[model samples]
Target chain A: MGHHHPGSVSPLRTLTAAVRHHRDRNVGPVKTVKLPRRKLDFFASVLQRFGELHAPVARNGHFVFQRVRRWSEARLEYTRTELPPKKYFLPPRETLFRFTPGKGYVPESEDLDRRIVLLGVHACDIYSLNILDLVFNGKYPDPYYQTRRRNIALIGVDCIPDQRCFCRSMRADTVEQGFDLFFYDIGDYYLTLVGTALGDDMVLAAGELFESVTPDDVAEYKRRSQERHQRFQLDVEIRDLPEIFEMEYGSEIWEELGAKCLSCGSCSMVCPTCYCYDVADETQLGSTAGRRVRTWDSCLFATHAAVAGGENFRHSRASRVKFRFYHKQRGFVAEYGRPSCVGCGRCSAVCPVGIDIIEVINRLRGVEYAETEHAATR
Target chain B: MQATKPTVGIFGLTGCAGDQLVILNCEDELLSLVDVVDIRDFLMAASGGDEFSTLDIAFVEGAVMTRRDEEKLQRIRRRAKALVAIGTCALQGGVPAMADGLDWPSAVRDVYGPEGDGFDALPARALHECVEVDFSLPGCPIEKHEFLGAVADLLNGNPPQLPTYAVCTECKMRECDCLLVDQGRFCHGPLTRAGCRARCPSYAVPCVGCRGPVPDPNLGSAMDVYTSKGWSPEEVVQRLRTFGPLPTPVPAGEAA
Candidate 1:
């Protein structure tokens, strides 16, 4: 029902009435703000006013999320940022501690007090961050990652998939949670859904820049969401993934993947949820003072599974390939009750040799397709 | 008491001495490094002696493109306890290796005319082909940080950490846009080894793979990206062959 007229009631009174109605409903309030397409840049600038704003920008003919100096630099329509937003939380190279050769190691603390606004994040990436939160914040929590996570804010936006994207299959195409704010393009206005209190605070802070969403805006948002779902070209039935991975442990598909895989570690590096790391100590050139650093490590490396005794647990290429898939699909679910892959299509996009996850899943299902041979070679 | 510093030598052969220049470019760290390691021989930085001497570590640059180069590499290998190949030219035969499949004599004649007869040259080959290499630090011009880090590792009795991943790893870390996917450019980042910190991509240039191919580079997938972008198989192969040897040839009868 559209609220076309409020009998000349004050805007604040109308807002209070709406909030009270939502409170009475005994459910979390869903607040939506509308920003005209022309004012999208204004909203971005507003975000920048608060803290460092990172959004997708064109770099060397490709789109990457970089620190923006101006609102015009942000590419809201981008399909995907080359790398996921995980780098902000968990950097590739991070100092864990500083140590003296004879003395014990001293833990290195980072300054995570600065505010950072991650803008234009895709729904898939938001989902990926949620998955990372579970891992980093569970059991023995990572203080460095946790500190950084707390300092940064997330703002998600809707994305149109290229053929490579399979987030829909993984139920990551639209996120119900994990973002402070989620934006959906509806005609000339952006329908901004305030998912958290932080999002509401942001909306309130920039109150003059946004208006309350109309009933027509809501309808348009729903229509566009439906359209986005239908547009996805790739789909994997994730419900069957655990069973499929378990049953296909001895399948020849892994061998095919092994043949195609270079084990160059591109897929995992670009993946938002791949969080394995290797820690090393580096002594200074002349001094005994040194720092201990941890760097991103990939499961695909032959030495990744190698033990101190020189026995490699997952020695064969086929085994490593199988291990990676099983870890993401079956093992992760077994441990965390969910698959690790959010299906952002980064692995497929960056796999120099075309080892697409969708195609692999299809082939695992024995789907007769001409592209299977080509994918196998890739 | 002056503790005996680990003896180290820097040598170059038949390519651009860019890798050595990169080491010298480490202006801040260079002076401090000399205190940790003995600079037995560094012709580029010093001219103490040309004669080969026993050393604890030898950092060799360039590729072996002649009998003299091969002999020099063997001598270094014999004298040094550890030999580190510095730069793509030394590690993978680099630009010099591009002439491998071509007729050497004719190629040389084409470049130098009849006067090329006076020059004696051989097909370019990696240093490891002639002698054992303890480690390899690969790049067009080796990343200064990596060089410094590797030397530090060796001094500490730790094996120098080299990147086992592709250039895509660094590119992703740097958050540089994927040229291959977004712009349909033939970037070899996913197939090339990392350590250059995605330099080319950071500046918006396509990765020409100056760091050489990763140990298990997925050449087929790299080719697929190019082909999907409307590049011919020949064009893909040619682009790939620019930095390192092609993994496989595009079969005959494929559209050029």
Candidate 2:
């Protein structure tokens, strides 16, 4: 029930264990591999030791999670990945069942239900997983997702001091639970760390490959994560959030975004956390055989909020845009007790029209409310 | 199928029938559902009845905005074996929930001049404003698969579970490049629950969080993420309430 992780683990020790864990299963409790200034070969070692290895790799001028067979394939120092590591658990399109109408739901299929070990997950993404676990594991429990989740070996990496990160502000800088193992890419050594029983087991098997990390290293990792928060040089104060919302209930900013937004949903599609989806049942013409599938959806599209009677509740792009903004910040806070945004900045990075959430927050905070209010008075 | 057959009744009050439509969209499976249970009363479907039979489940859609609707929902609650609040209207009041902080009379006046005397007025709130509900399925229209899952589980002698994870979970699962990383589009996926599998993201759009918030979503972090991008607190708040709700804090250590 509890994540129960001891403090943070050293990145160097974590890598050492990863390589040792797979190379020789019988190796003395290989749970981590502290890469102490090892070149790309260390990464290759992990790949060779384990059947496969996953890490962030630069592709088409963007970073993405890919299979790293050799160390050269790994891009340890990068800006950001196109998609977060969460795909390893609950994929975009997964089959919940195969069915026939008269017989009812068949409830079994595997597309994204394969065993995968995810690596290089950032803290913001790690927190995103916790959210996913809550959803898929809650109430009835999604067996498909659970099976994949149970099979995964999460390996997290610290946000490099670059990449314009704001994890500190969003608290994505650190996660108390979710990852099985974590890695902090220190200059000389990649601190291979442990976060769970399985992770501990992997580390125990690594033998001398992993040693007890020094306290200075842990403090340095925390320091780097914290210091990097300032490097982004962009932020919303969060103090005036409620008050800003009060007046922003009817702002012109929403219409502005709507006018330019094509409603393509590319932003949501690429984000590390947007999860709206639609479900439909399909079958061949003459047969009763059919299966219900859930596909992703976006509130930005007019049809997203449309109902049976042809009435669109959040009809206007402004309203729809505003609704999304509120849900992550104010709406979710009131309903579930926390703001839903992880501050990954994926939305800001992927918009075709360049609608920045940070800018919206600033406008709402009266970055110019006073000037606008005065002009209206005049 | 009548051996201890589950008698189910469905009712809608005010707000968009999006939730009802989601159920209706269950088309192919609808017939199967009918075969498994005796649908006692469903106002939107051809299967409603006035026999006033005992009910095992009452799927309530829309917010209880009117007095008559309130009474009807209360009666249904009394008669049904279980009560589920479907859609944001029933759960958090949907778009109508937008009226929560405002005065109804003024709102009516704003939309209609003093001559708009045809409008009826009453105290309003989410479904909780009128009756007790056992479960709530958020989103303007509750996700159909989730609805199906809950219904199927209920029929199988189990309760349905709703996802409390933020929308970010599904967004990442889509393997979509984080839109905010390369562009400046703001999204609400991190704060919104993961019940809906981030359909908007797949279509290359940012999430507007129609399904609402996950339990214990981190507003501080969301704001920090934005602010780090030079967004002010007001801007973050604006984004949080894009759906008409001011992001609130989660209960202590509660799992989303």
Candidate 3:
């Protein structure tokens, strides 16, 4: 029912043990283990024994990560999920505290010790999770988020870039770490790379299903990675994006975008790294006792910037639109040394009005032009 | 000392009494609600003599279409301390308000006869237009949870917090695939107010703007999306008009 705690040993001893384990097998820290296509179900079933299993599944012609009981339910070949894996860590709504009228509040902390294995996560979403880690785990760490992150294990899968995906431009098309295990499709088998000790534990649990990878298999894995790199349909030059955003602060493009913005907050809702939230108290009918809950909020909403004095910081649609972009592209980088956007394309895919991030970035760079025909007709 | 329960009334005017029925649909919570509020007037669920003297809170549903409907609404507004417009009809005039664009007299005559079949008719108007409405709970049929929550908030001397965001927000939370983006369907989710938990999208149907538009919807952009997807400007307006006409009128014969 439980596994040995890695923390029980000293950091030096743990590293030495890992090194000894790898040397004993004559493998590098990044070893490629061959998983035969037929053994996927057996492997998933074995993984399920470790924790609550979740994977992407086909729903209403789109993919969404949902709890899966069977291996067959996991749609491993899907391009993108309607919602990112962020929901597992930071749910849409969660109770923060409960309070009675006279009595003070009692914090409703979650039990984060329960094991959860998220399978079939794409590279961009994994990168997004890493960005979230920097936000929630940095400075004054959020205990709730930190605990949930500690309990969950991420399993990454190589994704075939769709027309909407621009992860390559963000340098998030492939991840080196932050995942327990990463799977790459190499013809008849999956070349699985163990990224962490937890991944090594998983491999040991289902050792029979995996075989030591040969040199030929490693070559095939590298060739497949190269092939996927060229398949991306969208690209954005992100090196000087922060500078461009700074210069384009007063660009007319924002006003044009604001005119088309629905202000629905769908873009933020679907974005993996957008973690803005609002808290409210919900009391029971005819009772003084209630729970304070936190729900996902968006800066795009009109009331998001409103204060008690009726002063709204970002009053106009243009300001809100610009603020959202600048926050993701420039502001985050100034604070975190990296842009918050992982180029997952969920925002573009979910936007009702077809506001693509790549187009916005390219237009900002003066490399592309907006469709003037539509604007002129309007 | 036991606290006196607040007197409440539930009334309907000129549309399908679906919203009141939704209140009845809250079978589990209905009993608890009854224990909390003193329901003085509720015609749909329970039959009682009209005691419209003074109500702590009144939930009025349906649109005010006729002279009698307007008078009844005014009477309710006078009696009730706080009037909450429940359902799309009372909030935005609902589907019945579509007749506002047409010649009412001719439409009424065509429906009935030259010698009118008795009841006087007028253009469908929202309750707020006729009387002072304290709050509004908007939806095709008001969501049961929202209705109950509003009632609870009023009982607790708290203003009921309503969602200002569009249906697209809830649709995204439900993780439903964007019909407009994926299939190029004319979904009104972006423009329409939420609080229905995106029921239509969850069931694979596009939002029909039945909950009415959000506070500051960019209709121009919404129409642009539709027109770009090959939908005619007339088609877009027709769809928008299905629930009720927007506050800013879509120009006549203009391709969006």
Candidate 4:
């Protein structure tokens, strides 16, 4: 269902810049390393010099993104990680301060000063993280998160000629500019496109490391990315997703998911973009030593919103389940013009219950079964 | 610092203790709160003071889970010039109420030792269990910001203006594609209250109905949303049943 054109690399391409500012050193824009794929030395050099580089590192039977000091530790090619690359921003829990008898309060917030380059980020994770950026960087920007974000740079790599991926369905197959720089593994050398000024500065700074993309490099990157797009396993007609839910607002599917839902909040936890949180005040041993802290919150919690008059707004597991999906898929996008779910596939992949997001979205659209058969079941 | 201040007491009951934790989270404005409100008792936080005079303002959390708790709540109500319910546990019975399922006896039996006759509880009255509650601020643990807003409002001689709308409305305003329509996912935003600003949804989490049902929520529409998500009718009713410890068959501000 696609074609290969001679020069239309509009969908995907690799380009350098006049003033690219990629950072290789922890302090400056990235210093490029233009070595062959096997030249692990280049990678080693980057990680070694930085002392801190976080990329997709395998761990716990599932691929988890972690800090990497060497090339061997980095896993460039992967299907999906157990967790999306969200922990990089809003950590699971963070203490805001410590307070006691009110003589003085202590703020224990820390910002990671060491620069981190996130490698092998999937488009979905990119999309999801973008939503997070929009949120944390909203009206009142979160100083804690912003400090780290400004120091870090995102490096996105396309999924290896797909075994299976639903990023396209979730509208995340292609990067619409979130990364400071993008890398498409094109055989010998990475076809890199400097995205932000930081990216351009880095690329320009490393004039010797990265070669300008010739016509051939651009062509190869396109061919490979397109092939993957066509072959990608999940095909969701997402344009009409909102309409599907609108029509099925009375559907029985919600309760079904709810019934099986452990309400464990695992799905939300693994999600790259799920950032709902709760702020708490932790007093030290005395009334004086405590600080306000923030931790991840789940909608599945039954008491999320109940009033004194004894009214429980969303008390059902189904409702919790429903609210999570609607908020991500539709509500969030409508409000922020950003899709909350970056299609990182972490939620379904790590779900103990085996609820696949792709499957759920398809079902929402009434994937199969005629009206009669469906009606009979109902 | 301000010269004089109003006396306020904050308390909690059976939920996850999230509400108390939330208010305690008011970091920047905390010292100010401590200065302004003379907190007499906060079961979750402070060891508590005993003078227990008429409180200018009383902040209560969690549902009435015990006889002692009921008595404590009544005392708070009677003694406080103003009372505010903070959190789902205090406002709506919270999760414990979900287990009630109308058949209070069976619900109790489901818990306790056996024969529905074990450590006698005041026969759990419809999850709210007992006591008269004044103002209500819902949320698993009241949103720290919202809790502050409510407190601040009270200080300004105006109660916090909580959103009485459904979660779905906020979701829509957030421009989140309907989860049910876009991705066959079930969400109770349509029937849940606003105020949390639909945080869960934007975070990519579903509405769990922790906020409790909205005023005159369209149970019928909510059930229909579930159907589209491929849930069975039985599942829909079962879901709705869990949230309304004491079903709000009528609209908010209307009769039971």
TM-score of each: 0.82, 0.53, 0.90, 0.54
lDDT of 4 by residue, A1-378 (tens): 011111211111111121123232223323333335665346445533333567777653336677776678788887777566677676655665555563655555354455777777877777777677677666545555655566677877777424335667667778666776677778898776566776665555544566766777778878988766665544556786766777877778787776555454556766777776656554431123446666555676554555467777787768878888888877876878655776655566434345566767778876752222322343
CAPRI quality level assigned to candidate 1 from its DockQ score:
acceptable
lDDT of 3 by residue, A62-135 (tens): 89998898778899999888889888877887775678978877656544456788999998998898888787
In model 2, what lDDT does residue B35 have?
75
Instruction: Give the whole-model CA lDDT for all candidates, comma-separated.
Output: 0.78, 0.63, 0.81, 0.63
DockQ of 4: 0.04
lDDT (tens digit, per residue) of candidate 1 on B97-173: 87668888899999999998778788788888888888999899999989998998888787888776777778777
Model 1 chain B: ten consecutive residues of lowest lDDT: B247-256
TM-score (chain B) for candidate 4 is 0.85
Q: Residue B143's C-alpha lDDT in candidate 2?
A: 85
Choose 1 or 2, whichever is better by DockQ. 1
Q: lDDT tens string, model 1, A251-299?
A: 9888777766767677888899998887766778866689867788788
Q: What lDDT is obtained when candidate 4 is compared to the true structure?
A: 0.63
Ranking, DockQ, top scorer first: 3, 1, 2, 4
Q: lDDT per residue, candidate 2, A77-135, as tens digits?
A: 66677766655654555444557766756554344334455667888888877766555
lDDT tens readout by residue for model 2, B56-170: 8888887767778888888887897788888776776666655555677877888788954556655345677677777777777788878877776676555565555556546
- Sort all candidates by TM-score, best to worst: 3, 1, 4, 2
> Candidate 3's error at A145, in angstroms?
2.1
Error of 1 at B110 (Å): 7.5
- Candidate 2 runs further than 4 Å off: A1-33, A39-52, A111-113, A161-164, A215-226, A240-243, A368-378, B1-256
How many Å off is the CA of A184 in candidate 4? 1.0
| Candidate 3: residue A378 lDDT (0-100) | 35
